[model samples]
Target: MPERPEDDDQQLGSLRPTRYATLAAWAAVGLVGGWFLHPVSELVNATAPVVSWAQPLALFLVAAILGVTAHATWRSVHVRRERLEPHRAVNRLVLARACALAGALVGAGYLGYALSWLGSRSELADERVVRSAVAALGGLATVVTALLLERACRVRNGPDQA
Candidate 1:
């Protein structure tokens, strides 16, 4: 049997791009989570010696790796003659989507925590603010890279296919 146009349309629509609203919702959840966790973090800081630099650095590294991988994947898929494996492409899309959501949440949470520390007169307030800000930046980087990766996964249709 011949394939219907509607069937092809449905298949194309299944590859829809990620929505901003979904990201926003995740960020909102992060904001609320951060607000709640701020006090707990402060309490833990008071009780134990915590390294402030590690979190941001780790996030930054993850972001950099994701960005590089995304770029390579895009180049391989669009510019190079080699075709991407179906399983590999699906895996990349899944990873990108997961990272995008996670990055949004983490970034919002760190930003919220940093805002909470702003203008505080406590001895560790400056350090906390700075670290949180850096972490937030790292998170932002992850979000941006993840979004780019997601976009890179799009399979452009040729004139004949379209």
Candidate 2:
């Protein structure tokens, strides 16, 4: 049977891009805050005792925390939007996406650094590393944006069945 306009509207209404936008905005703010606080690419240079793992790990942790903050805000609004207390089902989705975004960011940063480090000295290496880093950053951001958009869809439409 064909879907009705009401059904389509329901589906559309179920989506809440506002929530995702809010989350992204908050995360971006957190990132800006981190930048101001650090005043340098802390992710690139290892500042702690464990440089080997600390750099990437720190970046991941920071990004994750920011994601968490964003998710929390999303959850709050979701709860209010649905006129119900935060649902575990929905909250879990938000958390999962946030974690995924954080992981992607960390991975991309590390790969960028590795590519650059491996290709050091020569102009070709420098160019290659820079290209890789930019690509990684763009990919991560796209993933994050997609995830957030998906979450927004879920918020409005309820979870999709597998």
Candidate 3:
């Protein structure tokens, strides 16, 4: 069963934190969907799109940006270096939650795609698997950074709270 948030969370207008189970569910969906892509394309005689280094690099860049955001948020809110606006914090929190879920799906999807290429005779199989695996790792990093951002948004007990 999903956890029920305490009354105080609602009273403070805070959203319930994103759950790992939900991410897992999305990843499962992506995995199954990705596994079918190759076979379906083959049946239709369509070629698979090339997986490139640029894809993984972009994901890694996003992860880096999120990590910086998380660190900034942690300093502003948790460390009390500066006061953060309520709306901005909420926005960041929502972005973090959404990205975390998205990252999980993308990661699993790439992993499934890579697995499908294993033992295949095509010369492209090795390239696809290697590139897809790197992309999957980038996606995992995105998820980790996003989760860190979410955790950074938490408001610790301070002099104002009861």
Candidate 4:
């Protein structure tokens, strides 16, 4: 084997790329917990708080931020026109991964919450279902954007670029 340079890059820990199965597992956990949330609340005569537009709005905002960052990363890394600092790139990659897992869990939770509201007699059920579904959609977007950002953060050179 050829001798390698002694640099910090050689010492930095490498993390495996995020996988669909891992995300699915986290979502499943969130779904089960969220599915039970309503029944548990009802069992204790607790009031289910009404969901509003803000929940989905906030989730969408997070997705938008990730999307924007992904775009910038793609332009900088893929185009070969600019270079990102090593630390900044690493930080962004970490952020993307963390957000991807969070998005899956959050999206699934909201989806399960929406499912739980189906066939319910509560006056707010309709609103809850609608808002929760929209929130779930936002969570999906966050996951997609975060994954894109993670891919964009990869530093490739020469024939292995793919």
Candidate 5:
């Protein structure tokens, strides 16, 4: 007569991998954001150059930390040396997915902004291009780290893997 909670849980158990279409959608949003922010970025850079350098460094550091953590978690699980708490693992997986999406958006936006600066002869344009490139690299690192983290969360053929 009534649906059981277990039935809901069963439906949710069929976990699927992240889709490329989702990533592409996020990237599209980022492209729009970058296009819209280009003028503002130019204005900000004219006043202060710190953000252009700092943002990329921050993103890169985040990526590195996530990557290391993912590696450790994967190794521990693969060897059966440690057990990951269910809640913690779930949280990490969610974080990884969010980062992956965000990274794609940020990377696309930076690239778009950089492209907008191409063909400009001003000294500021040169600086913007370099900074944008660095930021884009940081974004790429974030995406890679997130993807690795997601992969690490997958269970192999074991009963407790999920």
Candidate 6:
């Protein structure tokens, strides 16, 4: 027998748990990728002194963003085809937003440190501490932003939390 619309809606809600599972899996993959990217990027930085400019690094970051966007787009399409609202995939969106914010903070922090290192006359300990504090603040901001986004999405898509 063909499924009823309510049955479909039930199935659609089921997608939420599946989406959460996918988000968890993707988070694991991202963690592995982070490890891999670190050594690879460090090696590139250490060995390829010729191309360590803003342009190449910026392009690299752009490419990484594009790749992530593509992955998200594909997953969103899949969810839509299953009759689910993409925004209801809260877990995935939250995870992606958190990761994106974290990455942005780390990249900006490293850039700040590099600029300070290049401009400073001495490698002062206090300066290092200040730079680290700045990076910590960036991480805190990212966490706050992720929490806000998640809350917003939840309020828009679901009933109010008690």
- Residue-pair clashes per candidate, as listed? 0, 2, 0, 0, 0, 0
Task: Report the C-alpha lDDT of model 4 over 5-70, residue by residue, as the tens digit.
Answer: 755444554556899999999999888877888888778877775678998898899999999999
User: Over the stretch 60-161, how does candidate 2's per-residue lDDT look in tens digits?
Assistant: 454555456556546654654543344654564565565555545444543434443453464344544444455445435544644553453344435442
RMSD of 4: 3.5
lDDT of 6 by residue, 57-160 (tens): 45345445545554544444443333325554555465646554554545444434433344444435345435434443444344344433333333223333
- Judge candidate 1 against the unseen true structure and give its global Cα lDDT, from 0 to 1: 0.79
lDDT of 5: 0.80
Expressed as tens digits, the lDDT of each residue in 1-162 for candidate 3 is: 676677655667757778999999988987887777778887887687679999889889989999999998898776765667878988999889988998989888888889889999997999999999999898899999999999988875645532
Number of the candidate with higher TM-score, 3 or 6: 3
Best by TM-score: 3
Error of 4 at 30 (Å): 1.1
**Could you tell me how far off, in angstroms, the CA of residue 82 lies in candidate 3 after the best superposition?**
3.1
* Stronger candidate by lDDT (1 vs 4): 4
- How accurate locally, in lDDT, is each candidate? 0.79, 0.46, 0.86, 0.87, 0.80, 0.43
**C-alpha RMSD of each candidate structure in angstroms:** 3.2, 11.5, 4.8, 3.5, 3.2, 10.6
Instruction: State the displacement of the C-alpha of residue 89, model 2, in Å, after optimal TM-score superposition.
Output: 1.6
Higher lDDT: candidate 4 or 6?
Answer: 4
The list of candidate 1 runs beyond 4 A from truth reads 1-6, 9-13, 40-51, 158-162
- Preferred candidate (TM-score higher): 4 or 5: 4
Cα error, residue 44 of model 1, in Å, equals 9.1
- Pairs of residues at least 3 apart in sequence or in different chains that clash in candidate 2: 14-156, 15-156
Instruction: Quote each prediction's TM-score.
Output: 0.84, 0.33, 0.88, 0.87, 0.82, 0.34
Q: Arrange candidates by lDDT, highest first: which order?
A: 4, 3, 5, 1, 2, 6
The positional error of residue 124 in candidate 2, measured at the CA in angstroms, is 21
TM-score computed on alpha carbons, candidate 5: 0.82
